[model samples]
Structure formats: C-alpha cells, structure tokens
Target: MNIFAKTGGNMTNRRDFLTGSAGLAGILFCGCGLPRAAHAAAAAPHRLPVTVAGKHVKTIDVHSHCLFHEANALMGDEAAKLTPPINGAQQAFMTVEDRARAMDAMAVDMEILSVNPFWYGKERDLAAKIVSINNDKLAALVASKPDRFGAFASLTLQDPALAVTELETAMKKQGLGGAAIGDQVAGSEFSDPKFDPVWAKAEELGAVLFIHPEGVPELNKRWAGNGWLLNTIGNPLATTIALNHLIFQGTLDKFPNLKVLAAHGGGYLASYAPRDDHACFVAPSACDPNIKLKKQPTEYLNQLHFDALVFTPEALRHLVAQVGASQIMLGSDCPYPWELHPVDAIMATDSLSDAQKHAILGGNAAKLFGLKGVG
Candidate 1:
C-alpha cells in the first residue's frame, strides 16, 4: 500500500489518501526521496522544519527560563518578587514542566535555563534568598534530567562578594553551564568601578554571563499604561545602555576574557553603532580614556555573542553579516508568546551557506555549552 514503492507498483487508493494530508505527505515525500535541504518547504505554518546540519543534529537552546515554586512560597504577598505571580501574562506561560515538554516536542537536545531579572530586582537580602532558591531549583531540575536540561545560575549583583561565592557553587559545584547577569546591577552599569571584582571572578572561572535587560528602577514609570509598551522599547534600550557603557568605558577591553552574551539580538548595537562613531567625530574626547582602541564601538559588539532571536530573515542575515556565524547561536525565547521559529527563519535566509547554517543552529552552541560528540 506504500505510495512511494517502485514505479511498476499499482496506484492504489492508499497512495491517493496519503498525498492529501500535508503533514503526512511531507514526511513521506521527504523521507522517501527529496534532498535534505528541500525539507523546509513542506513545513506546517507554526512548526520549524528545516534541514538539520548533520545527522540527528542535537539543537541546544541557549536561552530559556524557569520559576521556582518554593521561592514564591517564601516571599509574602506584599513583596515585589518577579516569580510566578509576576503579571497575568508571565504567569500564563512560565512553567518548568511545560517548558521541558516544549523542548522535547521541538527536538531540542538541551535547554540552558535562566531566571528573569524581574525576580531579583535590587534588594540584596531578598536577592540573596532568591538566588539560593532559584539555584537550588535549577540544580535539581538539571540533575533530575541531566541529558535534557542544563542551566545558568542567577547571581545577586547587589552583592559582588556573594555573587563570587554563588558563581563558584553554580558553575563548579552544581555543574551549571554558566551564570546569568542583567544589564545593570541596581542602577550601577557594568563599567562602574564597583563591578571589576565581579568581572574578575567570572573571567577566572570562564563563566558565560547571559545579559538580559532590567531597566533602571526609576524609569519603569516613564512608560505609562499601554500594556507593556515599555517592554518593547525599554528592554532594547537597557541592552543598548549596557553595551555602550561597556565599550565607551573600557569594560570589554579590561575584562577581555569575560564570555558576555547580549539578548534580543544584541539590542541596537549592530544597527546604530555607525552613527555613534559619527557623533563622536565632533569631539575626540567622546572616546573613553580607559579604552586605548583603534577600532570603532561596533568591533567590540562583534566580539560578543548574540542569540538568533531577531525574528526575521533580513535581520538574521544582517546579524550574521555583522557578527561572524561563529558568534551567533540559536535562541527561541520559548513560551514568551513573541517567540519566533528559529529553524524556519534560518532556512528562509538565502545569505548563509550550509556551514554558516550549521554553526547558527547547533555548532556554535555545542561549543559554547561544551556539548560533546558534536565536535
């Protein structure tokens, strides 16, 4: 009854039936005869069906989140903790078990988990408790399913000394992938002299710091009542602020070994940096005294890592063209509602070669996460 049998086989009704359903037809046709790269053309509207770089290509999602039920139980209702009760919207999508299933459904080999910065805020004491609880939960989750999950620990940047201690435990003791840090630690930017010690510890441990946007505590009110309009502009601006401070103040040059990663496709760093240099043309002093670099601000941006969450074929191509494929990796931002289909987006792009696609999908992340056997 197989429709794909030799040409001499009878054209049975079963052959006609299989060809009608798009999903089944795609699987049968691709599985039987088409070239690997052509598989994406048959994808369903919401699904990601692209050519995997290699056989059984194990995709590693470098960006994802988890919430600790225990942490919420500890804080009283009045506290502004960014856990389960964060907002009706966040609560709707954030579930560890559900996230795991989604990863499995998407054929993700592993997910590098993190806690959002909203949960930690700026309270040192509360941040400490949140860190312990979150780290405990992450460790247990990864340990429970070692093959399917890995995590990056969140540190209380409010206390650098405590952050150092936490990094050792998270990266060395618990076998986490690395650490997650925000754009600013309680309004103090990365270039502030106070952060040198934290960066030093990260450099020594070779930790990967996933930088997310947590806008200044004072600025949240500036965007009033439009259903998280601030999130769109605010998040990207926070990242931009962090990158500018890091570059203009010489944080990147000083802490060359820090494996810092920027979220939301590296914010505005890739697109707007040329104008930055043009503005600096009026004053030579616009460049920081700390940095002795001959290169422009965009050069440092290229040196950092970016996740492929830009959400467009054009944006993806520009990202790759700006930063080499080696610096880009897959990031679905899963369960975020705004999540884009990374595999399909990558496949849709005509600018990248097969080798570049491989790096963006799996190869770069495999190396970053120390994923074995893929090397």
Candidate 2:
C-alpha cells in the first residue's frame, strides 16, 4: 500500500504538505481552532502534537541552527579588524516567537539548536569569550522554552585545552546537551591527536558532538562561480573529509563511546562506506593495518547519528539501508530553507515502515538528547 494511502487520506506528498495544501492546516491545527502562530505561542516551547496516519508523532529537528545576536555583534567587530570589511546589514536574527511559528509551519515539535562556526580563527582569549557568550545565550534560550529547544554548546577547538574546560562548563554548569563543532579547526583536522582530550571528555560526559560544516576554505576558488557550489558541494565535502579522517585515523576506535552526529546525512561517507571496507580487505597496502580498528569501518556507522536532509526519498532510503533507521534522525536544516518540507519528505517515503518513520522523525533524537514526553 502507498505510504500516503496509509496516512488515512490526510497527507499525500512532501510538496503538498509543505505548501499547506491537502488538509494540511487541519492536520496542523486539529485540536486547536486558533491560527498556527497563536497556537504555537500558547504551546510556548513545547511542540504541538501532530498526527500522521492517525498516529501522533512528535517531530524533533536535530539539524536546525540559530545565531545569537549579541555573540554575532562581538564576533562581527573582531572579524572586521582581521579581514576586509564587507558592509551590509546583518540578516535579521529570528526571534524565539518567529522560530516557533516557523516550526509550526514545518510541523516540527522540537529543535536541537546549533550555531555555525564563526570564532574558529580568533585568538584564545577572544575565542573563549565568544564560546562563553554563545553557550550562555543558548542555555538561556533553551531554558526559556524547555520543551521547544535544546542546544549543542560552542567550543574553541583551535585550543583544545580551552575546549576541554569550556565543554565541562557547558555540560556541567549550563546543562547543555552537547557541543557544536566545525569540520576543522583552523588548519587542524578533528583527527589530530591534540583533540584527544576533547574527545575523551565528550565520551565521558556522553555528549553529542554535532559536526556542522565550516566550508572547505581551500576550495573557495573552485566554488566561487555560479551555482553556490561553496555550500552545495563544499559543505558536504568538508563533512566527508572530517568523518573520513576520524574513521581512517581510528578516532572512533579510540573513543568508541563518543556520540557524534553528522549533519547532511553523514555527508557522502555513509552512502559510499562500502568502498572503505573493500579498500581495507581487497587492497591491504592501501589500508593501514597499524591503525587497528576492532571492527569493520562500516560498523562504526551504527555508532553515529545522521540527520535526514538528503531531500529525496531514494536518497533517504539508501542512507537507511547503509546506516539503519535508528541512526537516522529528522533534520531540516531549519530556518535556512534548505529543507522547506522535512516532515513530508520522511512521510512520503514508500520504502519506510511507520515504525521507521517514527524513529527518524523524533524517537531517535529524543533518546539522543534525553527529551521527555516524545515516546
């Protein structure tokens, strides 16, 4: 039977659900007669219930981002002194109410907020200050809407010692769920030995390290032309490189308990992981026996989490086949418009069972972030 047909004739395809057609407003506003915005305000930080196929599911978006206005101002001034000033008003920061309404439109129940890396190149003291400010703001925001938002703390990985201290403070004092990090720190890849302390700390704390892309600066010239390749290709390419380093260098082996969540569906690595296995078995010379992993490279994929932002049913299905449903979580890359219809994307997949869809939508993330009332 078609997945849409199983949904009791309420939703059909991703496009329709996103466009707010085909009884979408009714589905979104089922119990409440109020407008979506007003309903969201009444719910405040908690996700309003959404029913799919007569089953209520709480949608958690693990890949959404936010930019704290105060942190941006401080960093913006410092950035100006270091580089050529590009003049323009900053993109208006979305307020909490604005974000809540947007979430309602997307049918998302909760968001695990993270900020894109901006202080990776700052001096140690300056970077520490920025990390403090970002984490504090994120903590307060999540606290204000406990049901609606959770956050990954920011870290200054360029100085791993400071990163360790900051991570401790964020997790212990601020009660942040995890830390958000870029693919690389300055010129240092995450696989560098200098980061072992940070990794060890995360493993101990059981924190989820969200690896968002900072863009591959070396490829700027190639991505400069039309088509936005810098983001289209560069972003995933950066994540792919970072994960590869961690895999091949045995970072996952060293810290097996490290809970890492890769954005953009684990980039290109998850889909192409079999190649690593083949290279290790078929081409021994190409593989380093000295690295010494306890299991096959692909097996480590089960140990990690990925956001379902692949944008197509086929791609999402392939990722599940590669990683498994439990490892895949809903991630819209929210507020960026990269995925205007995330819930519909998963709901429309003919290949997934209702159980699988439920897990990807919110169950897995609820477990990962320790969210309540999602079961």
Candidate 3:
C-alpha cells in the first residue's frame, strides 16, 4: 500500500495508521505533507547501517575527496614533479557509483566531498574553470544521489575574490555544505591580509572551511625525492606549520567565528600542543610577543572539531581524552589506501562511554551539519 494515501478529508486518520506500520519497518517514512525531495533523501540507501548500543545508527563523514582528474590536469608541470605521477584514476575518485559503494561499505550515511586543494596554486583562469567544473560536478553528484553525498565547494584561493563568488554560488545555489581551502595559497600564508575578504565572507555566511595540505613549495624542496617524505611526513609537517602560523600570527584571534576544520586528525597539533604553549610562554620574544593568550594551543583544538581518523583505538582514545568526544567527528579519508575503517576504529576504542561513542560515530557531525534525529 502507498500507505500515505488519503481519502476525502480524513487524512489525519490515514497518517496515524501509516506511522504504526512504518515504525515496524524501521524506516522514518514521511507523509505527503513532507517535501518530495526531503522524502527522497530520507529514503536513500547509501547510508551505513550501524548497531550502536542496540540502536541502529547512521553517520556523516566530513572529510572525503572526489574529482581529482580535473585537479591533475590543471596541475600541469607540478603534476610531473609529483613523486609518483599523480593518478588521475585515484580510488573512490568521484564517480557516482564508486561513492555509493564506498558509503555502503564504510556504513557512512553521507560523505561531504571536497576538491583536492592541490589544484589551487596554478594559473588563475584555469583554477577558476577547474573550480567551476568541480562545483558543477559536485552539485550533480549531490542531486543525483542526495542520500549518499553532500559537498563542500572547492575555491581558488589564488584569487580571493573569485573564491568569494564561488562560495556564494556553491552555498546559496547548490546547497553545498561549505568551502575547502589549502593550508596556504602558493607562497602566501592563510593569515595574510589578502585572504581577509574571503574569511570575512565565510564567517558572514557561517560556512565551513575544510583545510587540507597541498605541500607548500618551500617545504617540498626540503623533503626532496624521499619516498613518504612529502606526503606521509611533509603533509602533516605543513599542516602544523600552517596552523601555528594561523594561531601565533593572530589569524584565529582575529577571526574567532571562522570555522576551519583540519585534516589528518589536525596533524601534529593534537600531539605537540604543549610545545606550542611552552614556546608562547618562555620565548615571549619569539613569534608574536604582543599577542596575549589565555589558553594553550590544545585549547583551540577543543574549539575545533577533528575527524576520528587517527587509525588506532589508542590514538582515538587519546583524542577523546584530550578534546572530548563531542568535538570529534567521523572521517574516512576514503579511497586513500592508508585510511582506516571509521566505524570499526571507533568501536575498538575502549576509552569512550556509550554516550561518547554515539557522538563520535555520527552525533557530532550530525549536529555540525544540522542533521536531526541523530543530534
């Protein structure tokens, strides 16, 4: 039966009966009163089905990638310079089918896709076009499989103005979740005044800025040709460098409302926070002497949310102990060969209470992305 069917004027009686059967089916079915699009999203099958504390739970993954081909092509000379010639066909790399399968395997309800920021440091026109194509593709990905995916628009930080325009178009028009920017734009740091306009706009709109590493040029030269040096090590090294720069340089201080999410479990920041704090204390003459501080660098980490991608249960436990579970989100850096199983990893962690487990599994991201029921 199309259970929501109505007759004449007794619609309320019909819905009351339908709810009983729908509940038995374990589906949160909506009536004709709900929007058609909403109903469709609610019915999508790409969701990961989890049994948490006896209740079936679902999740939202905040950090997943898609569409590397466009970025690879746009990278040009930089592409050749890469250690292993960037693979245009990277796994889970942005086809609708691949995404659906991955979501099902990982039990991820939806993945918020971001364009790799590796495409950002090149020619302005090409970067803009690449952004446009990626946005269009992302929007189409969501529209086609609204239940499986959502997007955080990629921006060309090379031109801050263009970034603002793309942000508007992606958020307002396409209903994207947020924007993703590299840790730095080319040689310029994220805290530079040139990016203030972009930051201001993101704050005004309450947009999320997912920060990822693109191997800073100067840092790249230092790690030269060593396998696992640039990516496995240098990437996190770059993340720490950029984060410290943003903090000590007063970027976070100035833009208190700006929401920036860091990848790879916030890199080395999570582990070496005390050093950052100590440096601030002893060498008041070092970085920014005039900048007054109240808390340690780790305190800011609590304010920011991190993905549960640290891999080991012990690491996950340490993260939970350090930042609390509510601030940790589920991120399956899926398609990356080294990525961990998010649900299993969280389950293996003995440090978390049932409530904390609920939050790490899906509750945190649900609240962050405004999903109901779970939150």
lDDT per residue, candidate 3, 1-375, as tens digits?
Answer: 222221121111223333343211111110011112221222322335777787766677787775434334556766544323333322212334444655666667778887666655578998886776666656655654556677788898899998998887777776677897777887889889899888888877778888777765676676777575777787777777788877777777777778777787777787867777778568766766677655567677776767887878888888777777888888876555344356666776787887887787778877776655654
After superposition, candidate 1 runs with Cα above 4 Å error: 1-42, 45-54, 78-97, 119-122, 216-222, 225-227, 285-290
**For residues 1-375, could you state the per-residue lDDT of candidate 2 as single tens digits?**
111110123222223333432221111100111133221222333235755567888898898876544455567656433221112113323346656777887778788888778888878888777677667666655555668878899998888988998888778766689999999999899999999999999999989999998778998999877778888899899999998889889999999889999999988998788888777677889877789888788888889899999988999999999999999999977555566557777877889998899889988998987776784
Off by over 4 Å in 2: 1-48, 77-91, 281-286
Model 2, poorest ten-residue lDDT window?
24-33
Q: Can you give the TM-score per candidate against the true fold?
A: 0.80, 0.83, 0.80
Global fold similarity of model 1 (TM-score): 0.80
Better of 1 and 2 by TM-score: 2
Candidate 1 or 2, higher lDDT? 2
Clashing pairs in 1: none
**What is the lDDT of every predicted structure here?**
0.66, 0.75, 0.66
